[model samples]
Target: MEATSSGRRSKQIRAKKRIEQLKAFYIHLAVFIIVNIIVIAGAVSGNMNNGQSFGEAFFNFNTFSTFIFWGIGVLFHGFKVFSYNPFFSKAWEERQIQKYMDADRDEMKKYS
Candidate 1:
């Protein structure tokens, strides 16, 4: 009797994890936008009596401007990955899955 390979299963798990990560990233974006809106709204309702510039008062997504640069970065990365050659992208994922499968096969062979 032979044991079935778990590569496909492992790939599924990896894909699921990636999806969750993507979802979390989008959630962060949503929160950021909403929070910024509230902040800006508060600033708008109040007089500009604070001893700081507008740029200094609000959260900026710009890299040179704030830490939000990373969020902007991976957002574009996700955009480019989705926009350019989706077939190639899927192929890359499949290849990753197969590579995991093959590694498992090799390991099992070594044990047997």
Candidate 2:
């Protein structure tokens, strides 16, 4: 039936979108790890060149600041890709549309 084919197509489209979201999240995670490692290594080397010991350089605030700040961004990206935000969901949009329609109807009734 046409309805059955339409339902199947809808499901396929949703699955494809979910797959793309997952792929993007994975790429984000990989880049976060690689870039943080490079940043930390560079900071450690720079600190040591400035006469600090290896442990002092590795544990300094400057070394982990990039990881901490960029980590917050990564956390938000993970939430956007994997979690549902009820405030912006389709159901919320539908409810807002109905509310506006009801308000418009009441205004028309008042005028008439």
Candidate 3:
């Protein structure tokens, strides 16, 4: 009974942690959108004031550069929050652990 309760508590803790991660990700996304909008707006206004057309002001690299660069960080944060690690998954970690353990065992055999 105690073990079951402990397991349930652990599950609750994990759920809470997941909820917090999701909340943080959402907040990050909101900030990213808000700040990028402001930056793009400012760039557009500044470019237009400098004699550029609306099309040139709104569609230029400088207008979207912040989004392009900071977007990569936001994407990585979202990936982490969502547990979408393509480079190092649980299976990959398990394989790495097994590989190291095998190496240790081989070293022991060499000594024995």
Q: lDDT winner among the candidates?
A: 3
Error of 1 at 53 (Å): 15
What lDDT tens digits, residue by residue, belong to model 1 across residues 37-71? 66565663342345545655443233123335544
- TM-score-best of 1 and 2: 2
Clashes of 2: 0
Residue 111 in model 3: lDDT: 90
Q: Per-residue lDDT for 1-112 in model 2, tens only?
A: 9999999999999999999999998998999999999999999999999999999999999999989999998888887888766558878889999999999999999989
How accurate locally is residue 30 in candidate 2, as Cα lDDT from 0 to 100? 97
TM-score of 2: 0.76
Q: Which model scores highest in TM-score?
A: 3
List model 3 lDDT by residue over 18-88, tens digit each: 99999999999999999999999999999999999999999999999999999999999999998899999
Q: Point out where model 1 deviates above 4 Å.
A: 1-4, 48-112
- How do all the candidates rank in terms of TM-score, highest first? 3, 2, 1
Query: Model 3: runs farther than 4 Å from truth?
Result: none
Backbone clash count, each prediction separately: 0, 0, 0
User: Total clashes, candidate 1?
Assistant: 0
Clashing pairs in 1: none
Q: RMSD per prediction, one decimal?
A: 9.2, 2.7, 1.3
